[model samples]
Target: MHRLLFMGTPDFSVPILRMLHEEGYTIVGVVTQPDRPVGRKRVLTPPPVKAEALRLGLPVIQPEKLRGSSELEEIKALAPDLIVTAAFGQILPKALLEVPKLGCINVHASLLPAYRGGAPIHQAVMDGCTETGVTIMYMAEKLDAGDIISQANETILPTDDTGMMFEKLSRTGENLLKETLPSILEGTNERIPQDEELVTFAKNISREQERIDWTRPGMDIHNQVRGLSPWPTAYTTFGDENVKIWKTEAMQTDSEGKPGEIIELTKEHILVKSGDDTAVAITELQPSGKKRMTASVFLNGTGSQWEKGDLFL
Candidate 1:
């Protein structure tokens, strides 16, 4: 078995590490980001990959910064035959990249030359892309700019959110990596360079990006809500409180009110006008300091405070 070093930091990376272990790959060491302070209580939490590695009895390293760290030296001492990274969250230095005998490779969420930054899956869904896929490629100095080793496609359903797409792409990447690694080690797999002209980036999502723009077309608002669901979710202000919109649908009715105006309200939906003269039906949401709930449930409790003609600012 080839000695391997695995570097990753999230739930998406866990499947690949588990699959590799199940298939009898010799994962000599695992490197993940340092534990982060998470949530309302500010609890220090380990990365998903680190937790999984411990469960598997694999050796682990948590480096605050990869460059010029003794952790890099420890990784080099492992003398890995291959290094595999998936959503590792940091760029590898040249010294570390060159240490592995068969070279470093990455399992990226998008087809190369497109969506090549930190948040590809979310960006694709936000852009209303019809299809997206996984790309296994060599690790270059630049961000996700490596030559491709293998690629696999998946359809983007109209209802797919960032969380759903993450699950789908993580599994696809796991299977693709398993099938491709042997050929890669034997030097039989092809590496195709990406076209610079076609390159596009999926920049990290910002607080501004997560705010719902009610003035946009209804479908665009729908896509924004879907793409960000379940994490750093799409939000809007309702009076003095922020409400996270977890699910919405674009309606084809002609708007009888201005953008952001509440055109219709029921126990099950809140229909609001958009800049394009249509509306979006919000079906699920989380009010500030509240748990997520169906629109009907929320309406049953707070409906008395909302009336048609009210606006979500």
Candidate 2:
């Protein structure tokens, strides 16, 4: 069995870790980010991957920074054949990468030479991609610029949100890792160079991007809303109040009104006009300082009067 050291910090990394363990990989140690303060209590909370590692009785290391000589020494002591990283939340330094016999391999959530950055999944959905996939690549000094070892494609469902797509891609990534690692150990796999021309960067999402611009096309609005679902959700202001749009769909409507104007509101959908000849049916929303709920439910609870011509800023 190949000896490995795992480095990851999110739920996305959990499935791959479990799969490696079940397949009997020698996971000598796991490295993850330290606990962060979470929730109203401000209690320290371990990352999902770290929690899983502890539960599995794996040796866990939470290093604040991996660039230090002491940290490199600690990793060298493990004498791992390979280091596997997935969403580890830290840029690994060069010294530690050389410690492993097979070096580091990253399981990225995108087809290489495309969507190469922190938020590939969200960027794919926001750009309205028809399909995306996973890429297992040898870790290099640069950001996701390494040669690819393996890949698995996944179709992007029209109704898929980032949360749903992530769930699918995570599993796909795990299966690919399981298949690719053995071949890599046996020297049967080759690292194909990525196309530099096809490379696209997915910079981390910003709060400004989360602000829904109703002036855009209805489909753009709909895509942005769903793309950012469950995290920094696309939002807009109703006068002075913020409203996070959790779910919406584009539809053709006869209404000719200014963008952001509420065209219709019913139990099922809250229709809003857009500048590009369409309307969006907003089904779920989160009003300022309130939990997420249906638009109708939100309206019923607040008793705030909004009419067909009322515009959302």
Candidate 3:
């Protein structure tokens, strides 16, 4: 069995690591991002990958940065035959990349030559892509500009959020990598260079991206809400309060009003006009300093006094 250095972080990487271990690969070590504070209480926490690696008895390293660190030297000492990384959160250093005999490959969350960079899954959903997939490719000095080894597609459902797509693509990536490794190890894998002319980048999500713009079409706002849901949700202002929206639906009615004006209020929805002359129903949200709640619940409680014609800033 070849000695593999497995590098990844977060829940999306856990399944692939487990598959490698269960399949009898000799993983020299598991490298992930360092533990950090999480949640309102600020409890220190290990990434999901590190937690799983420890449970599987794999050696784990959490370097804050890989470039010019002793950790890179330590990694070279492992003498790995191949390095496999998925969301490892750092580009590989040149010295470390040279350590692997079979070269390093990455399990990227998007199809090659498109959506390359951090936050591929989020960007795809936010951009309303109807399809996305995983790409197993050789890591290059440039970011995600790698030669493809294999690829697999997963449909992006209308209701699928970034969180859901992460789970779907993670499992898809794990299975795809498992199927590709034998070819890779035997040196029979296909190496297909990406089309530079078709390249597109999915850079990390910005705070600006998390703000809702009522001036957009209803479906666009719906896309924005779901793309950021279940983490760093889309936020807006309502009656002097900051509100994070977790769920919304683009209505099919002919509603018309100023963008952000409340067009209707039902027991289950808070329908507001959109810039496109349609309406969007906000179904779930979290007011500042409050837990997420269904619109129905908010309607009978903190939002009971809200009425139609009221505008959301």
What C-alpha lDDT do the candidate models reach, one value each?
Answer: 0.93, 0.89, 0.93
Our model 1 lands, by Cα RMSD against the true structure, at 1.0
- Candidate 2 lDDT tens digits, 48-113: 998999899999988888887476678779999999999998888888777887879999999988
lDDT of 1: 0.93
Spell out the clash pairs found in candidate 3.
none
Clashing pairs in 2: none
Report the error of model 2 at residue 143, Å: 0.3
Number of the candidate with higher lDDT, 1 or 2: 1
How many pairs collide in each candidate, listed in order? Answer: 0, 0, 0
Model 1: ten consecutive residues of lowest lDDT = 298-307
Residue 15 of candidate 2: its Cα lDDT?
96
